[model samples]
Target: MNFKKCLRCGCFFASEDSVCPSCQTKDEIDKNSIRNYLANNDTPQNAESLAFQSGVSIKNINRFMETKEFSPLKNSFK
Candidate 1:
C-alpha cells in the first residue's frame, strides 16, 4: 500500500486520500456549519466571512468550493 502525508494534519496515512480520516470528519463539520449559516441567513457571504463565522480556515473553504461540496454557496465566494 502506498502511504502519503495528510494535507491537513501532515500525518502519514496509508491511503489515496489527501486528508486523513480525522481531518475529513472535521471538514464535514465545518462544511455543515457553513451550510447552516447560509441556510439561516439571506445575505450572500464571501469565503473570508464564512471562514470567520464557521471557524474554518479560508483555505478549507476554498477547497470546498473547488470540490463543489456546498453548491448553494458556490457563487458566493469572491
Candidate 2:
C-alpha cells in the first residue's frame, strides 16, 4: 500500500489506515452515519439529497451508498 502524510499532524503512514494514528479525526467516511441517511424516507432517492436532508456530508453518503457497505442500526434515528 502507498503511504500518505496526515493532514492534521504531518505523520507519514500507509494509506490503508483511514486516519492518522496521531490525529483522531477520520480521513475516511463514517459508514454508520451514511447508512442512517440512506435507509430513510418512504420513497427511494438520491444519496446527495438524502445527505442534505439527514445533515450528513455528501461525500460520506456517496461513499457508503456506492460501496454498499451501509449497516443500519435499528431504531437509532428515532
Best by lDDT: 1
Write down the TM-score of every candidate.
0.78, 0.44
Q: Which stretches of candidate 1 lie over 4 Å from their true place?
A: 71-74
- lDDT per residue, candidate 1, 20-74, as tens digits? 9899898888888877887797635687888887778988877777674665466
Specify the highest-TM-score model's number.
1
lDDT of 1: 0.78
CA lDDT, every model vs. true structure: 0.78, 0.51
TM-score result, candidate 2: 0.44
Model 1 deviation from the true structure expressed as Cα RMSD, one decimal place = 2.0
Q: Write model 2 residue lDDT over 1-78, tens digit each, in one string.
A: 789876445788887654476553442435444445456754235555556776666655444443434424222222
